[model samples]
Target: MDVGLLLLSAAVLIGAVVLTATSGDRRIARLDRRLARVEQKLDAIAAGVGVELPEPELGHVKALLAEGKKIQAVRAYREATGADLKEAAQAIDQLGT
Candidate 1:
């Protein structure tokens, strides 16, 4: 292929990637907002019913951290809190610090 044709093809590929990423980001952001609203509503309902959310126990996770087993700590945190992988990892990292 000619240099000009190759350059055009590359530009098109890059544009497609950018478009896909942008749309995906927007969709994720939208979902996050929706989730926040739902959580707020749930919180209000819980408060109205005098229902209290219990704090998750992280003793095992802390023990794992003390043993220098970060991955296992994250796993334990996730199991304890039902947090996603990233949230669990971040929480474990914060505890380590």
Candidate 2:
């Protein structure tokens, strides 16, 4: 999960490609499979770290808050997000008047 580790992995993969381009060893001749594996790894990393989930709808929660019903707003947030009491309260608190 470290940025340095990710950069090192990319650098190593690039170095391998460059080495394959210049070297003549028969055993290390091709990079197609290796590149595919690197692509898969990069895809997995992106899925885990870069993907963004959409926020839950909060129109009803906002309406409740506008009506000065804080408790009902927290309950709406909980139902919308499936968050527990504390989490919903904290989230609704962040959306201050």
Q: What TM-score does each of the candidates earn?
A: 0.69, 0.47
Candidate 1, residues 8-93, lDDT tens digits: the string is 99999999999999999999999999999999999999999999988998899999999999999999899899999999999998
Candidate 2 lDDT at 76 equals 92
lDDT of 1 at 14: 100
Cα RMSDs, all models: 2.9, 17.8
lDDT of the candidates, in the order given = 0.95, 0.87
Worst 10 residues of 2 by lDDT: 24-33
Decoy 1 TM-score against native: 0.69
Among residues 3 or more apart in sequence or in different chains, the pairs in candidate 1 whose N, CA or C atoms overlap within 3 Å are none
lDDT of 2 at 31: 72
Candidate 2 structure quality by residue, lDDT tens digits, 1-97 = 6999999999999999989867856545457568769978987987889875588999999989989999999999999998889999998889853
